[model samples]
Target: MSAQSLRHQLLTADKPGRADLLFGYLRAHGNKHYEEEGTQMQHALQCAALATRGRESATLVAAALFHDIGHMLADDPVEANNPTLKDDLHEELGANYLKGIFPEAVLQPIQLHVAAKRYLCTLKPAYYEQLSEASQKSFRLQGGPMSEQEIAAFEQHPFHKAAVKLRGWDDQAKDVNVEHLEIDAFRASVLEALS
Candidate 1:
């Protein structure tokens, strides 16, 4: 199906049908990966799976699944193919697009997940060393670790904790060989969170 058609389906379809369309979109457009070990779809599935396994809220699981979708939706060549390129701010782009469709529970985490990475680096002295090569590269483009003031301010956001947890799962989601729950598994959760 065309990207436009799939997007339309995602916006207007029923829960189960939306799941199928989302899965189709992921399978088609999620093949590109600049830094991570797996395809974008794999990483998304893994992140959502982690959230599901942890028994996080349905909105959180949906947030985890859709966090990086901005990367796929961006028209700029640099967005998906080169994280080392200008910090495309895909998080903001994705979050903005989703805001009209999902509740704050789902949208807020996507907006902050990138900052969560920066915050994690500040909170854990050795966190920078644990990042994958691509993440390490993107870190510089993404403003590196947060400053003390930045951390202090970031902590004030209501979704800060959830974003941090999502960031952790995002980091862990790059394992190419890991088993993952199917995208359709979250139909109920995603549907519930859809605005």
Candidate 2:
């Protein structure tokens, strides 16, 4: 199936588990990657789970889960370095692709994951120092260190805090083992909650 079709299906998948989409992405597109210490898929799922556990809203959790769906859609592998000579702004790419499919509730956080990372660096003393060299480079490529106006604007977004927490998890998710719930429509209540 084409990547475009797959994303359409995934957006409307009868049973859309963050883990399922992520695992699918890993099996299909993930090349050896580095974002601190984990694979790209690992980073997204961890971010979602971390947000959920922190009592973040369902929109935030959904954003965490689907944030990197763009990586799967990118023209080439984007982990170690750009797979293509052209730009592979996975964060923006992911958010743009997702906005067409998911509600803005979901799209907003997905879009902000990168910003969340940058924002975290400014706030979390050890954050930048702990990033892998590749991620450090990627951060600059992704637009490092939000300017005062940019940071202020970014911070005001509704789900900003959860986005930051998810990014922190994104950075750390790959460094460890990942466990996940199997894909099934979340309990009706869970689905309703997210919807």
Candidate 3:
């Protein structure tokens, strides 16, 4: 389906229909390469697997699976990955797109996951060194690291901890060698998250 059709489905479909449309969309577009080593589908599945292994709530697991969806939703997903472009703000775009379909438990973490990266960079200088080269470049595009005030505010958010955890999984999810569950494995969680 075209992006317009998908958006229409998301806007008008029932919960199950919305989930179906989203999964279909992912199946269609998720094979594209991400900024890192794995395909976008691989990253998403890896992140969701990590969340499930960590025994996160269903909502959080669903959030992990779809956190980078804005990259797909971008006018040009390939270009969105370019660090030289202004930060795509994929986190906010994804969260906003999912707002009505998912509860805050899912949306908040997706929204804050990028900020969580900046927060971690501030909290642990060593963390910056650990990022993949592509992530490090995008980090600069994403405002380098957070300030003390930004950290303070991030800490105060209700979902900060979840976002931090999600960020950790995001950092780890790029391994090309790691095996991951298929997108269908997340169907239950996705359906459950839909409102």
Each model's number of backbone clashes?
0, 1, 0
Ranking by TM-score: 3, 1, 2
Q: Candidate 3: list runs displaced more than 4 Å.
A: 75-87
Top lDDT hit: 3
Model 1 / residue 85 / CA error / Å? 18
lDDT of all predictions, in order shown? 0.81, 0.62, 0.86
- Model 3 C-alpha lDDT per residue in residues 34-152, reported as the tens digit of each score: 56878898999999999999988999999999999888777455434434335457898778777678999999999999999999998898999999999999989999878789989
Judge candidate 2 at residue 46 and give its lDDT. Answer: 65
All candidates' TM-scores?
0.86, 0.70, 0.91
Give the per-residue lDDT digits (tens) of candidate 2, residues 1-195: 454445455557644462355456655664445445555555655665676677776666667666776665664433323332233566777766554445677767677888888887777758999987877898788777878888899878996876776677666656456785332322322253333
Clashing pairs in 3: none
RMSD of 1: 4.1
lDDT at residue 90 of model 3 (Cα atoms): 84
Candidate 1 — which residues are off by over 4 angstroms? 1-18, 75-87
Residue 40, model 3: lDDT of 90
Specify the highest-TM-score model's number.
Answer: 3
lDDT (Cα) of model 2: 0.62
